[model samples]
Target: METSTFVKEIAERFSVINRLHPTELLLPLLREIAKGSPVSRKTLATVLDWPADRVAAALDQVPSTEYDDDGNIVGYGLTLRETPHTFEIDGQRLYTWCALDVLIFPALLGRSAYVSSRCPTTGEEVSLTVAPDGLHRLEPASAVVSLVRPNASSDIRCSFCCHVHFFASAAAADDWVAQHEGA
Candidate 1:
């Protein structure tokens, strides 16, 4: 077969490989590819229990690969770097890989309290006024924060991070705060 034909076949095979919805697996695959080695379609097909032609079809469909000016395939695939706007709250950062931290502050505050920052992490851009006190000031204040949120309706929760750590509505937080004033 001609060089161009061979390359085209490789591209097609790659497109088929993409059918695996291979996302998080990208890093490991890229690292292996970077070792100055070539990966065989057969190997991937065996691992995925897919036909080689299917793999090639998936790869050909993807525009993610790189090609030379002459339209020859050069490389394929990339690795995951980072997600946009990963959030941090109350000195702790939320991660996709782990279970979420329990929301303990609001229940502790009991009555209510007002937060200026929209929220601890989601950045939802909400404003809440709580009454009485979540925990009656049982915990000493070290750093007080205000509003922050990812977007609108964030007004319902932490304005910044957008985490619905608390279970009260804007009116609820307000009512609680108002009812237990000076407590």
Candidate 2:
């Protein structure tokens, strides 16, 4: 697939995983995390002039939210502390939960990004430089991108539960697909 098509497909698939509804506070918090800042729940509460419990409750709606020792939201679904999807933007090193995240974040952030990840099946590293224009410096010219939208038609939270894996070859990805029946 062309880089733009690949990126769009990944973004659309992952769009199912997002804030349940428009809230006064949750989306802003998540967007901040998307910009690579670790935000303290308490600070958010204070700044937004919202109750602490209200802030916490809103944050809980976000997927894959990782907290620090002090109850700060260190990671959200689009950003992670440790993961195979590493995004290097400007001078900072950010992380995402999966390969698709690395592919799509540049468009979301409206910034150029340098991303690196590994093929789950072969463990071969794949890297790309994604800009607002397109992808460049992509390694491993041919690769298999496996997209699993588990429970897509169900009421289950698909975004948090879905999987997007990359592989060095179609055969390797097919092997993975065989092992994961539902997902």
**Per-candidate TM-score against the hidden true structure:** 0.24, 0.72
User: In candidate 2, residue 153 scores what lDDT?
Assistant: 31
**Model 1: per-residue lDDT, tens digit, 1-183?**
465765565455435444533443343333333333345666545555678786566455544443445443333432121112222223322211100111222233232333332222333433343333322321113322222112222121122222323322343344333443221
* Residue clash pairs of candidate 2: none
lDDT of 2 by residue, 45-161 (tens): 876888988877666665456777777787654554867778888767887766666666677667788878888878998788888667776777687567654333322224433
Give per-residue lDDT, candidate 1, residue 83.
Answer: 18
Tell me the lDDT of candidate 2.
Answer: 0.65
Runs of candidate 2 exceeding 4 Å displacement:
1-27, 34-37, 42-53, 152-162
